[model samples]
Target: MLPAMGDNVVVSTMELEKLLSMKGGKGEASYVNNSQAQAMHAKSMLHLLKETLDRVEVEASREMPFVVVDLGCSCGINTINVVDVMIKHIMKRYEGLGLDPPEFSAFFSDLPSNDFNTLFQLLPPMPNYGVSMEECLAAKNHRSYFAAGVPGSFYRRLFPARSINVFHSAFSLHWLSQVPEAVTEKRSSAYNKGRVFIHGANEITAIAYKKQFQTDLAAFLRSRSVEMKRGGSMFLVCLGRTSLDPTDQGGAGLLFGTHFQDAWDDLVLQGLISSEKRDSFNIPVYAPSLQDFKEVVEGDGSFAIHKLEVFKGGSPLVVDQPDNASQVGKALANTCRSVSGVLVDAHIGEDLSHELFLRVEHRATCHGKDLLEQLQFYHIVASLSFVQS
Candidate 1:
């Protein structure tokens, strides 16, 4: 069950560890949908990634082990692909300089509840759960690469000062540590009702979300600032909005929240959910405006915004099923449910999940499957270089 909401607390009350893990294995519960989308998003940023890596490689000491941190690296399927890209680029740069590449240590950090054992199983060894990084590396024809799982929230410190050389995060950081207090307050004018997220919210709801994002992002930058070395680079890709207003069609507006609202309203009509409960529960996710992100990073003063580009890419959730609306709806529903079911179940009840998503699929079909052909959400990719002084 979802925990009781807090009142007037400055600290986060959300159990981030419990809230964020991908479903273990390839079962229907698995976050393969999110991971696939994330991997594709990462692939789209390879050019920027390579550029940041090239810059990091120039200042890297050949003698010290090159460290790369993949923040919010959930089951390591997509994480491995991203790390592979970083390793490949580093190797090319070393070869160009007539020097052997430095030994690589890639740390996959996520919440403590993440399925690390399952992640480790996907390594070269067939079935060893207790194997060290050295054993895993030795088993495969490895390219001087080693892997370890560092379980922790990225919002807090995970490593010693100046420990990480390169930082990469995809499809993470939009999640707030907890729901903003103002929206949850009963007396406050910012109360957000009948929605899990603030996509089509009122002006007060938008301000509450933006304030929370600013605070959380400040903490994120500060933590990364401590971990990253001088002159190091960090690449971040997250869902963002082109328009400053939360209600604008350009940002997350209709693309995300409308579906949830549709399903919630359906449940309300069916008497499966109460209006009061619906009004109280809100999803702890935000798609910041591009300007919002730029100001936060620039204001932090720890990292220089090297490049910030907002692009729209294809969502992997929208599979090809033009002739079959049912199939298309199911595909989109399954993809979203894999990541959001737990939250929905927690807020409402486990029993309602099946019914809720059934309504969702029906709504999707009625809304036309063509809408799934292209995901109109924005992808804000930022390349940042840590300041020397």
Candidate 2:
């Protein structure tokens, strides 16, 4: 019943502004994106592209640098990882054509707050050896640009006019907190605590929030329209939610409350607040349903979808651990245990959050489910290209 794609539901630029700083609830914390995760996914994507190139008759040469860009370049590790993919693919393609590879510049981009120092750390060696991060020494390229992205929303202006080639964003986007007003009327009423489906609630507010999503999505595509060159490819990957009900949302990000839920639960056990307080609060998560993703992408006239894939239901990490399930549970809990203080309101009271680790371990041990064993996280991958006007 919400606005379909192309409605151009006008929204205030200011409201979108608030989402810029919105934080996900404790369960939404990130730990999967280390150097390894980055490399694994990046390489996989590279292989897929290489296979595609083998079958296609294309016209790209190293003489004129082809562009490769990563949005939400968080600290730039993943961007570097993605660029690694491009270089390898280019080399592979060159070998096939018997041509020397061209020099390409990577546009590492993200929110203004991104830690450039971290990104710069990876680049003292400008021309990373043709293969891997490890193979190359640090080198800097003045051509490598670090710039502030669109200020208020991803839907706004982000890059120069028609300057992008292949655009890639991973584990980013989908950070917008669902329209806050949509899920709550009561000051404390929030997502997954009977917000979206409340029959007697303020439908106007909810509609307003939903409209915001449409607006943001349009803006996002519009930005891509401006930033990306015609016929360029884009790969978007992010977490998604199945339930639209405001009262129920569960996933890797929401479950890992790994630290926050623990602290709050202890406070509840101590009679500090109702167990339901967690309801008013959700990790600032707004993972859309599969339909939501499709509608937005196809609805936008700017791009045509090339492919959409969903990966869910597995412990991609823990499954390979040599130990049995219980041992794996212990290991997962133990490794994440130290994250308690940094992730939660640990300063509010001494280790109020540390208690969460114990409960996590206990649940993982007794209930016989590691985080992934529970099988809650869902990933969505959608590829799209600009539609010719």
Candidate 3:
């Protein structure tokens, strides 16, 4: 078991799998309703996806289906949209070749706690494919594929060898497999005493986070390399930093600013929670720069990079309209809550989690305009091809 911080919380790999998931369901705070930013980011990569499909080599066997899997596909409309777009692009590519598109099997993969029920419910009804679940869903207007859910950590092997043809993931890879244990040790120099994230932490803490990211990303690539066919393609979009410095405020730092720490500090000051409790909590997320990512992929040597670039994402809230600061803050807060609320709730109780985000919302409202101006939600977009041995 991995120590999650204080002595009270010990997390096994399986427990971490269960805890690290987006807020489920279609409620206001759920990931489904609050994933507009993720949707926009996924749409930004459609051109790259098309390019990847054009370059991918698909077998012309009707007996073997073309398998496409979306890793870290949380329950949301964005997940559905991404799969639909990929299928359309693949079909178009095959039609241009004057060949019938092969049957497709779409796999939606995530942690065990993901809202698979809601995700399946949101999928469009499928035509009779003679599959066991007649109600099984597929991409909208494209019944050529059958859909199935694969629930597990993508850090581990989730598929048979040489099975997948195309893989896509967006805004997901930055998540570390688990928080660096050293940072949680009070006696260690890497202890992140005052911050819930490494964005503005000290050098030792930052190094610990970077090392963990490298390890996790390498493991992820290694697993995918085994599962992907020789000519298979992978298009990944994850949060990234523009600068090599982990503490730079221009990149992902803008999104996870001092507001969270401030809120926690306030709670501690108010005697709602102990300082030790606040110090023990840290978010297991790191946004690597392009160089950082390249180092890992090149080190793995299982996939050749076709394209890798950094791009910024747009805000989820309405920025064009007037008097939208409150709206913007609310949107940003909801977005953060959707992604990290589970972690916060697990550390503190749900009631304190609610109180904490209330403070976060207020802070975001006060600084919404500044965030809009300075925020650069950089993403490292990579198109890779499996390197044949």
Candidate 4:
């Protein structure tokens, strides 16, 4: 079973809509997807992740197969994609060395809700892509076990002791299931509503979020340490924020979150809801910085650093730009899916339909590079090996 990381953080569609409507629906899926440009960016991340794997020194033999575990594996598509790249690189390395290549065992893990349907509706019965990847998946000595290690969180124990050679996590790890205790109602720290967003945030609140990130990250490292061997490999790519301020405005990440707040504030001014209704609402998007990421991974005493880079995943794939109207509309409908049926019946009407079009128009022009620039994310890839005491 997957571990349940965040048992407390809960944000309903109505709350998100409050954020979405505040951001002119730019917070919706297509807009958010555009902001991340993840699918396109993933191609570049594939290379960085591969390099991380290559950095691991393999002990040549059949006695011990390389073990690679992907935390926050989510449906396995990204995990599979990464392995494919790592394999191609390793094959090149093995060819250069003029030695019979070694074998590997892969562990794909994720939260229960991830769509594993994409994983392997069916795995290749034989080594179709016979090279580096085959060794990683179907090990020669029968360690290859295609498994669905579904759990609520990655905080649980799953792998064998000193078994992992490479570990990778993508676009996750910054978020925990709950807000920190310091941010709750008990202390009444001063909170200010964002200029446009219905949700409120403050430095104290940001500090609380930071605390949770540190705590959760420490736990993640402790678990990974048990599984990874000395000189193990690690790579983590994720959505991280540049600043603690929720309304930091501009830059890829801040502009995206802040613009949504603006859209939400419009709704509040229109009297569609009261400030009290907004009080309890917190759209949790506390992205940790790359510094936080380095601090956590390096501080954990698990592995030595190989390389960490932050580049725009500006691969040519998404440069053509999607039909802004179509994608934005799709994203809006997706956001609506998060709302309760009762609320949909009561709150949505002609106004929702009217605002939806305005959003589509804005997203259309904000396409490609400019949109991606709005989110300054780090494509962090670090190689780690368990520290040999």
Candidate 5:
């Protein structure tokens, strides 16, 4: 039995501080550089988002602004695509109603440490793009799209009551607000040893991670419930598991973790990194099963689950050539590095970053592309609506 979470359990702020944000000046590797996998997921979620928007009751008054919020919008490229889809669909929906399309106020939100400047700078340079939000709204030609950044963690309230009409999140929400204290506590039964993450790990470690995810997600739903209008809609896309088993090693993230762990083990044998360092490090991410999601939404009672889907796919650039091991390896390596390199670097030290990824790439190559095809990447795209009384 792990020690209960309380004031005594030390939750490290330093652990959460290292999450990669697309910041720094030019030449720095932004989330944009490594977010191909994330972009693909966002693109896929567009259809679900449109479906939800179609059902949402819009006033469609030209004088009233239609507001949309992109929760956990890392950089702006993917958010821009999502917003563009929303705008296009919204315009069409209004046109279908024989009503003129209203102006838009799109809010791009993420953690405070997120690169808002980079996000704003990278905003779509469409006809309405302008010097400021005011200018963007003042445009006469094209759609009157106004975008701005709201920097905060979405696990808490960022907007006021009944403020937003549509909320969209992609490739986020798997991250807990903080690493579970049980995993970090030396004396706890849930003390995660040997492994950096829960990939079919011991029961205690898995429970600790799941509890954290549930608490964070419940908070997420509650906060959004307050901010969203009575009949507003949300489309969320996140990493999920097909099976209820937390120990399932079939998912791509877990499989990659296994390979990454092998590389770490090799490095440990070479005396390049201490086993203690590797054991202490864990990624604060949890891929909830569909059942887990249904439980939360049902319990919340604030949102009705309209549509839920789970499917498997891979990077579009990596075609289904199971014989091409090297090509597949490179594609997978690039995708992992982009998403997780920064987090790994922060934990294991940046000096070994290049060597570590090289080992990962080499390992992937050895594993062969056929292994990639067998690896299932479970993605959950959900459409939910506020349960109006």
Candidate 6:
């Protein structure tokens, strides 16, 4: 049964852990197929990643493996690609220093509901570092890093103190631990009636979202500070807004565009879902402004910031070709579905969830040109070193 989202009900952290996850498996609707945009975003930061790695001081020890972790590593080839790149670069850095590279141990982490089985299945038997199959097999024990899955929320501790040597998280931190309880309470000033997200919402609603993000991010940093080794490097990439105004959509306007809101309205209008239920459903996500992000990390004081900057990228949808509106709309719908399908399904059931996205696709098709114009993607990338004290 779907959890009740009554006017007085508060969405708990445990509830979110159960409900939030990408559409799993290898099917057309799976996140693995629809995450090209996320993959591209991560790829764009490779230079920064390499630079951060170069700054990372590797303490060689035969007794301890060189540990690295990718948090929020949803099921995809992208996760594997990232792990492969990090391993290869670290190995190269070791060879450049004329020292034997310690055996690598790459940990993939995410919520318990993430498609870990698929991620494991997708991993290559040996790390692909431009080596021949024969060579890879011969040096498997020596050259290839060990791979393991660690399932949990990044907002909590997942490893032993000072255990992880390096950490990377891409497009994940925007997810809040839970929807702010006040936003769901009808009596509260921050009640977010008729909205599924904070974008374009009133000031009170936006503030509620911002506070939740601050709390969740702080917890995330505190947990990582305990787990990361002294001088270890961490790289992060997450969606962000360009404007300081909490409600300003900027380029992310496309994500929470009128079309998305209209889809929910359609459901309510058709009596497919109760108005109360519609009101209660809110996506637990927040794209902080660059300043908002910087302030949180600075306040934490457990890590020294090396690089913090915002970059813009074109829409992940392939819209360069003629008659691209329909394609772009389909892509947008699929992307949204892949990311939020589980939540919608849990809230409205499978049949209505399918109906909801179909409406989203149709509406997105009609507004494709306008959406494309406003569809620029903005991300904040940061590199930090864990400070031992």
Each prediction's whole-model lDDT (CA)? 0.73, 0.50, 0.81, 0.49, 0.72, 0.83
Q: How do all models score by TM-score?
A: 0.89, 0.66, 0.93, 0.68, 0.86, 0.93
| Alpha carbon deviation, residue 79, candidate 6 (Å) | 0.9
Clashing pairs in 6: none
Residue clash pairs of candidate 1: 196-283
Worst 10-residue lDDT window for candidate 6 reads 133-142
Instruction: Supply the TM-score for candidate 3.
Output: 0.93
Q: What local lDDT score does residue 139 receive in model 6, on the 0 to 100 scale? A: 68
Where does the lowest 10-residue lDDT sum fall in candidate 3?
A: 131-140
- What does candidate 2's lDDT look like per residue over 1-389, in tens digits? 11111111122235334323212122323322222343455555554454432432224554555567777665535566566655556456666777654555577665554445556666535443354332332233422222223333355676787767677777666554233553433443333342212222344543444455556666688788887766677777765556664223345443444333554566668875454443343333445566667877777778777677665533323435534656545544643432222323312233444455555656555544445455455666677777767
Residues 1-389, model 3: lDDT tens digits: 21234433434466678889999888888998887767776777788888887778966766778889999999987888888778777877777787766777899999998889999888876666574322232333535567999999999899999999999999899988888888888888998887777878898888888898999999999999999988999999888877878766344565565677688888999998888888777778899888889999999999989899987776544344535778767766787788888888888878888999899889888987776666557788999999899
Model 1 TM-score (2 dp): 0.89
Candidates sorted by lDDT, best first: 6, 3, 1, 5, 2, 4
Candidate 4 regions with alpha-carbon error over 4 angstroms: 1-36, 91-99, 122-147, 184-187, 190-200, 241-256, 262-277, 314-319, 322-376
Off by over 4 Å in 2: 1-64, 94-102, 127-153, 177-179, 187-215, 241-250, 253-263, 271-280, 316-372
Better of 1 and 6 by TM-score: 6
Candidate 3: give the clashing pairs. none
When summed lDDT is taken over every stretch of 10 residues in candidate 1, the lowest stretch is 4-13
Among the numbered candidates, top TM-score falls to 6
**In model 3, which runs have C-alpha deviations exceeding 4 angstroms?**
1-12, 129-142, 249-251, 316-322
Please write out the lDDT profile of model 6 over residues 196-292, one tens digit for every residue: 8787888999899889998898999999999998879999988887888888765555675566678989999998888788878888888888888
lDDT for model 1 comes to 0.73
- Top lDDT hit: 6
lDDT of 4 at 313: 41
